[model samples]
Target: MNDELSLPATELVRRTLAHAKRLLPAALFHHSVRTYLYGRLLGEQRGLRPGRDYDDELLFLGCVLHDCGLSAEGDGDQRFELDGADLAVRFLEGEGVASDRAQVVWDAIALHMDREIAERKRPEIALVALGAGFDLGGGPERLPPGYTDRVHRVLPRLHAAAVLHDSIVRQALENPRKAPPFTMQGELVRQATGGSWPTWEHLARSAGWNDYEGYRP
Candidate 1:
């Protein structure tokens, strides 16, 4: 709830929820949110802090909107990530965020799922890595020789990323800024379940949500 980070956070949530409604399966909206939440937690546990060299505002905004494009055309694929990044860039630009800052968010979204981006070790790339728990792949020990030295300079920003992730997820769920789109499948699920939503664990077991196994945070 840092006021400094609130503006971008709000915009990111607003856009993401809207996108989710339009593009995600009604049954998958909750799961998608949970995946985001888990990603935040994983980032935190791995020592990814927020608000340091880079703006925590940018990091928070980017992380929340990172997966929004998944619903742009209604599927989970790399294209979704690309679309989401484009959407975020456009939104931030419209908001008059400095072009540089907007680019940071853009880069973060583009690289969140691409590890090679991390290996390149740019500060922006590192911020995205920390925000998405990308470093959790091979553990700290597996990092290239100079990885620690490079990231050390940006540790505080990393921490800010982690904190922003936690804050955004809490706000989104506790008081969802927007709801999933109304669709036949979503409506049917809602009606059949009496408005009850399944937990991530339940969805994982019943709907084959195993891609994230051992990576949940």
Candidate 2:
């Protein structure tokens, strides 16, 4: 096993996992661990050295806690990404993490769902996005032989995406403000509301559909 995979988790990391286990569903808890494993795997492939190019503990915190916002306790009035980021920042600060390092974790959680942007942010940001995408079926890449089996053996995939989607839609239904424009939550709200809300795509395509260039009505 690689050092990142085999090394023991720190107190903060263990605490975060324990807290997630209590607050999040079983599938999500496992998914969180899988996310961290995937991130660590990608980091190793890229030759990133722990405590040098990156902090393993910090990366673990970012990946494992990335989806905390989806839980009822972590769900705030903002987008789940932002809420999760806030939760991570608060927890890290409470654990005496430095401001700069805590910010790195915050950025990783906040931008994991945003494609291209997250990849361009930094190594930690890119790793979290890469890990999450790989887990969620983003594309086919050849991992180390037996990597998938080993990881899945420890952390089973429990159809996490579908369950998470349902929870997000439910949260958005309860509070329209939670679904901002052009966001994942916004799309979910639109879907849940029978397409009543016009998405940015719909609006853009229909902007001048029935209007003359100089006409104002």
Name the candidate that leads on lDDT. 2
lDDT of 2 by residue, 1-217 (tens): 4553563457887787787788688787877778778877777778876777877787778888888898887889888878989988888799888999999999999999885898787777878888888888746666888878888777778888887788788878887777876688888777767676665556766886744546576
lDDT, candidate 2, at 58: 74
Model 1, residue 108: distance off in Å is: 1.0
Candidate 1 matches the true fold with a TM-score of 0.42
For all predicted structures, in order, the TM-scores are 0.42, 0.85
Deviation (Å) of 39 in candidate 2: 1.2
Residue 7 CA displacement from its true place in model 2, Å: 5.3
Error of 1 at 180 (Å): 30
Relative to the true structure, how large is the alpha-carbon lDDT of every model? 0.49, 0.80
lDDT of 2: 0.80
Error of 2 at 49 (Å): 3.0
